[model samples]
Target: MGQSAIGTKMITQIGILVHDIEAVSEAYANFFGVDKPAWNWTDTPDKAQTEFLGEPSQARAKLAFIDMDSLQLELIEPDFHPSTWRNYLEEHGEGPHHIAFVIEGMKEKIAIMESKGMKLQQKGEYTGGRYAYFDSIPQLKVLVELLENDK
Candidate 1:
């Protein structure tokens, strides 16, 4: 097969949205035969940096990242808020939510996805990174998360 419209983004995360991050992360650890994630945190979008479909949104989630050889496995639990995770859970239940890519050329990547007719579903920034989710459900069967992290 040829290349996709989204281009060759280096995937960095396999993201899963669950009802309970701690419970599911532990389950994933056992299933994958690895220890639980060493990196874990919570994100509550600061209103100033968060947008859902270009509008402001109050989204919160608990996140955990398990270190793999090449890529990281990400676990997320939707807090009681308006967010992609909450929507996914309500519509599809807990499961794989999105695949994430960490890229350096953030603007270029976003433009590529936009050129492909993908809509920005969610976007926010954290300490060392910015993340955006694109509406790629029909083609990829899930949303695509673009991550640009300095750390």
Candidate 2:
């Protein structure tokens, strides 16, 4: 398929990682004049241990998923410990966390991006989907992600 076609078919989700769950959630809700969506916390200890960063590491986070007509907005609030979000916040404060593009050929796309010097930051499977973080962002820039919904 053409690159444009591949990109068009991708499920694009915008994620915001912040320190304050209520504040950020409220801001988005009020900004859009919509109620804050409920949080969906995935607690798969076995799955997380096997796929995620292991043992939760005291990094508690709340995720709110908002579904628009075409795209989904995911608001992530980092509680308790420091997470990737917290790290981003420490460096850049509140802003865009990552722009996720879901594609069918995740492995192939990741390989291509890596070959182009995009280093892999993190990789894991969660809720039947394979996700990876790439450290290609220039200083003070937001990170990018590639998500493959295996389900």
Which candidate has the top score in lDDT? 1
The runs of at least 3 residues in candidate 2 whose Cα sits more than 4 Å from the true structure, single-residue gaps closed, are 1-11, 42-45, 49-60, 79-83, 139-141
Model 2 agreement with the true structure over 1-151: per-residue lDDT tens digits = 4564235445578888776777777887888889977785543445643222322434446788877878888888756454566667677877788877777787777777677676656555677787776665763255667888875
Across 33-147, the per-residue lDDT of candidate 1 in tens digits comes to: 9887754555555632777778888777778888888888888887777777788889998888999877767778888888887788888888788888998997777899988
- lDDT of predicted model 1: 0.79
Best-matching candidate per TM-score: 1
**Alpha-carbon shift of residue 87 in model 2 (angstroms):** 1.9
Backbone N/Cα/C clashes per model: 0, 0
**C-alpha lDDT of all candidate models, in order:** 0.79, 0.67
Compute each candidate's TM-score over C-alphas. Answer: 0.86, 0.76
